[model samples]
Target: MQHFPTGQAEHKRHRRLARRNANGIYNWIMTNDVFYRKVLAHLKHDYSKLEQHARELEQANVALEQDNVDLRNALLAKEQQTAELQREIEAQTKASGACTRRWPARRNQVWSDGWNRLTNELAEAEATKYREKSKTRRRKIKALKNRVRTAVATSNSFEQWLLFVEQEKQDVETLLARYKKKLQAQNRIMTEARVLARELRRSAESTIFNSSTTVNSWCSTFERGIAHVIVAGELFSTSPATSDGSSCLRSDSELIYGMSTLEGLETARRGSPFSRSS
Candidate 1:
């Protein structure tokens, strides 16, 4: 077990160890180069994948922004429409309120006979105008319908039918437009009529106020004349007159002054010409 090696055997063993060490160094270098290449490749692949993901995210963000813009526009449009509808609702409500509140007062309240007659006349005029307008529209519609029927019945070919169809469409559109225009005009006229009625009411009230003021002024003047007459009567009673015996009698002007409103009273009793006109 303790025997030493010979020179030849020891030489071979040393040579084999030196060759194995050289091969190990070469193998280590090659393996390290391969590992480095694999690591570099993985790094590049990961970078490429990350870049692709970032681009996809950017595209998705762009699409989301576009969608958001469209949604905002739609929301704005809806808000605008809501505003318009609200305004229309307010206007319609006001119109209805006005129509309901004032239309009956003209009939119930008492004013000048002229005002009553004017209200009646305006109402009659409106009714007649509306009746005539409705009749005219209906007549025109009937005539148009008859014409369309005639055209349809007389058509002999497809071309003729097509022509008639086009004409019918045009006629229908024209009728619709006419109806629309008439309805618009009717609403406008109704609004104008309400305004006119309100104006008339105001004017009537003004007239009554002015009449009352005039009546007050006339009463003041009459009262002053009466005072003066009483003073004159006292003076006449205290003074000595000639033998004419005219002190007990009033003059025509005095009598007329005392009853200054007799004619108006009689006229009121007889009914005014204005009330009679209705």
Candidate 2:
């Protein structure tokens, strides 16, 4: 309890209060500075993240633009190809129409010529066939004419041959009739001669036994008599031998006279004018 001055105490009390207030304000300022430093660090991290996102967006936009440029180039090339195809189609259509208009007359002319040629060939072939047929028919007709001529000539020759054969047959028949009559006459003469020869032989045999003449003399006389008789008969009759040898037999004188007469007849025949003329 020390007693002091009022002005000093009062001054000391005011200074103490002011110093407490100042210390409280300084603690508040320190708290606020720490909070501001933490906030600044968070803001700095957000700003760096925003800058990286912006760089990625820019790279994606650039790639999209390049893809759009490639698509536009492909579209333009496709449009050019479509236009060229359309032009080619129109040119082909026009060319086909022009060929169709120009070809019909030429085609018809070719067809008509071919048809005419075929008809001419057929006509020529038919004419050839007709000519061949006519030639064959003419040959057949000529051969038939030749056969007819040959047949007619052969028939004429056959008729002539038949006439000749008939003439020969008639001549043969006449000759056969004459030969038959002659044969009958000769047969009768032969029969009479045989009978006469048998009688004469018997008579000569008896005469030979009784007569005084020799056998040789008798044979000579008999031969002379027979010769005279044959000569006389030939001069007088158609036959050389007498029909009856016995009847024709004569005496020696008579035989000699007959022989002389035959000689005279032969001489007269030679001297006759009719014999010389024949």
lDDT of 2 by residue, 224-266 (tens): 4455457446433432223223232333543454555445335
| Candidate lDDT values, in order | 0.59, 0.59
Q: Where is the poorest 10-residue window by lDDT in model 1?
A: 239-248
Q: Candidate 2, clashing residue pairs? A: none
Clashing pairs in 1: none
Candidate 2 achieves a global lDDT of 0.59
List the candidate 1 regions with Cα displacement exceeding 4 Å: 1-32, 99-278
The lDDT of model 1 is: 0.59
- All candidates: TM-score: 0.26, 0.34
Clashes of 2: 0
